[model samples]
Target chain A: MVALRRAAGEVGRSVAVHTRARPAQPQLHPNPWDTYHHTVIEPRRRLGLDAVRRGMERGEIRDDLDVELVGDLFTGPLLIRTVIRPGATLEPGLAERIVDTVLEGLRPRT
Target chain B: MVALRRAAGEVGRSVAVHTRARPAQPQLHPNPWDTYHHTVIEPRRRLGLDAVRRGMERGEIRDDLDVELVGDLFTGPLLIRTVIRPGATLEPGLAERIVDTVLEGLRPRT
Candidate 1:
């Protein structure tokens, strides 16, 4: 989880740089969707899905939950912060807050 | 909250329809980012920001959290499911799960 959040922070920083670099005509650059999928989502999907599968194997994550969905949940907020709410500062606690919310949802329910 | 979730479901359905109709070529259609902002984000932003303000005034939501940030949190997953993970079914429990997760995060922790 720590590593996953660190990756998320890195993704956020990369996106921030990309966004800042193109304030005038965002569309003139390569499609952000393509850039995001190639640069961020694919790699994170591998790492996050692997992590979730390991967690489930160790009885930390619920086995029934969709690993892909869990990956999306964990990364979605960071995506939103960078893409959806571009101007917002990447707060120090934002990654922890997002990771906790997702982990809480993914944890095996008692 | 019920109304907001209902609105989200509607947005999901609309996006699904849009996606299903455009299986041949997505970029040929209007920029989904524009469509999303105009058709979905703008209205939802208005309604959601209003709700968050009321929630904050009523002392249900913490004042410290950014209202726009909260709106993004509540809606980001749906956006992801529809736009980011377009093929995934809108699972019946998806909305509740997302809302519950956001509410848990927004709830004042002791």
Candidate 2:
């Protein structure tokens, strides 16, 4: 019984000692999804999405050319007013009609 | 009445024309918070927080020197093993005691 116990302890000790003596591998960088997630999606989604959505849903109902949606809300309204910012129109109905048409384009294809 | 209406229309038209003729201001870069938001906080929180939390909470309760807690949940376990991973110990209790101490350190500073 003593011999069996000591042998087991010795085995565990040796395995521990061996592992402790080894050096660590360095963490690799420029990891694939990290690059895309950080550069492309994260910032664009984190900041831009909320900003655009807020502008569209509130106040002046501003709009954009840059629809960086994850899925496809690709075709949304286009407003020269908000995009142009403190922008103007030649005729009032001209801008409104353009906006309505752009919005209609976004409807899911039936 | 006609004069009053015409004058109002003319005011609106001229204001519109004037705004359209103006040049757009270049988007200001290096907006103070933008730098910190993009570089300092966002990336750190987005990747490191999730990774460290996952590594610690899951598989092995891995730990760190970088306790960048927003409010301060500092002082977590120290692992020579999972941190050193596939790692081992001279004495069984050594790692456990150290981990317990580190964990205790995080206990609300109380």
Which candidate leads in DockQ?
1
On a 0 to 100 scale, what is the lDDT of residue A107 in model 2?
16
Q: Enumerate residue pairs that collide in model 1.
A: none
Per model, how many backbone clashes are there?
A: 0, 1
Residues B1-110, candidate 2, lDDT per residue (tens digit)? 22322332333233223333322222333364354435443443344345435444442322432223210111111111212221322243332332232232211121
lDDT of each: 0.56, 0.28
Candidate 1 segments exceeding 4 Å error: A1-4, A7-40, A54-64, A81-93, A100-110, B1-4, B7-40, B57-63, B105-110
True contacts kept of 2: 0.00
Instruction: List the TM values for chain B, per candidate.
Output: 0.62, 0.27
Q: For model 2, what is the C-alpha lDDT against the true structure?
A: 0.28
Clashing residue pairs in candidate 2 (N, C-alpha, C atoms within 3 angstroms): B81-B85
Model 2 regions more than 4 Å off: A1-30, A57-71, A75-102, A105-110, B1-110
Best by lDDT: 1
Q: Give the TM-score of candidate 2.
A: 0.18
